[model samples]
Target: MTLILALDFGGTKLAAAVTQLGSREWLRYERRLSPIDGNATTDLAIMRSLIYSLLQDATPDAIGVSFGGPVDFTTGTVRLSHHVPGWENLPLKDLLEKEFAISAIVDNDANVAALGEHRFGAGEGYDSLFYITISTGVGGGWIINGQPWRGNAGMAGEIGHIVVNPAGPVCLCGKQGCVERLASGPYMAQDAKEYLFKPANQLQGQQLRSLVNDNLDLITGQIISQAATQGDELAIKILQSGAWALGVGIGNVANLINPQRFILGGSVTKAGEIWWNTVQKTARETALPEIDFEIVSAALGDDAPLWGAVALAESALISK
Candidate 1:
């Protein structure tokens, strides 16, 4: 069995994996990370060390990298990333190849995950699928015929920055009312904080004071989800509001692509059916009557990016 080394670079953590080139069997390795602080050289060195530590026994035939940012497919360079400071315009593919002395391929992390899911997970048997992640931010990827549909410049899956409410909230992208500002984890957290400050509402008064009196930093998206799980109406309302924004985003994608399935994944998705229900309701309401499909959860969970990197590497190896 051929072995492939896969690395997933994200804002909050780095995940490495060793797996059979064409199979799902693998060992997982993950490390929590602090912000990279825009030190490109240091960040690259750290990534190299982590890769060496994880795959010391055997040199992977090809190294697969899925980076959390826009990448120029023609140049194999990362354009920019909001979370990881030092990742901007980095030549990730060339760097990995030189560092590991092996073939390497790099692409958007979300795109890679969509590829992985299309081939081996919930998207199997479907000709096309849309993978959307609701987490620190909203992102999406498209897999067409089991392959990622990277646009001409390789910046295809940037649906997150789409303007939803022109006057809603300011996004890091210097845009107002992007989908992410209304639906992402931070947005949910911000919404929860605002909800806590509303005037003496019956549902928020006691809980809000309790949450505040304890010196809690502030209401978080997770806290709101926890409250919702405990049947708090206010929390449920927040969830619904976030979910509706997510649905509008999905609906826009759906009308444009009309994919066979829309796979929702990421950390915030842990809110479970509460999030799904609202997304479904809004998506259906906003969708064109002529098109229909399933809106479902991603099956690969958090490990999707790792597996995706492996899969992309394996495919690159085969094509070579």
Candidate 2:
């Protein structure tokens, strides 16, 4: 039996799994939340623990890793992580290969997730699709012509940085109104916190305030969604705005690539019907009438990256 090891270095979590080659189910799996103040070293330690616990007495033929950052696919070097520090210019692939004494492949999480969806999840039967994750940060991946499309320098699917509202608040990337700035879960939470902190808006977010017991710092995208579901105007507005920004980005991407489907995943995608409706409505309005496409939820949910990692491992084995 050929064993395949897969790892996902997510912004907020770490997951590792071992499965038999060609199997759809994992033989062993483990996951843990990343420390709130964790950096690359801490994250790596946690992943190493999970990997050992999963592997036990067995050795895998190959390993695959999904990193939540920009990566040079050819070299498997991580450029940087927007949400985590100490990950800049890391030679992750080499480290993994050296540590395990086996072949290892690594890529950006978004790109790997796209391949995961294409091979085993939402985009399974589709020849072309775009997978977008709207969680801690917003990112996108492309499956073009039934294959992963990591454009020049492996930076092709950076839909999060696409300017949707150039006049909006500044993003960490020093850009105003980028899709991730407006649409990601953390940004949505930040916007809510900022809005409620204003004197004039104090009376506006009553429902939102109540959700967090009037503690503005406690506000999160999930809290905002809960508030929206309870009829909080401020929360609803923020959620809709994020949806709108993502929709605009999607529409533009559709115009440029015309993929058959768009698969949305991550925490923010669970903001309920209002968020989903706004995204659909805005995308339809933004796209030309001639463009036809469908937007759907990801089937693999948070496990997409892990599954994608398996695919990457399988590919590595095949190439060898």
| RMSD for each of the candidates | 2.3, 0.9
- Each candidate's TM vs. the true structure? 0.91, 0.98
Off by over 4 Å in 2: none
Candidate 1 residues 91-120, lDDT tens each?
888877887788888888789889878877
- The number of residue pairs in model 2 that clash at the backbone is 0
lDDT, candidate 1, equals: 0.78
Writing each residue's lDDT as its tens digit, candidate 2 over 186-287 gives 899999998889888778988888878888999989999999999999899999999999999999998999999999999999999999999999999999
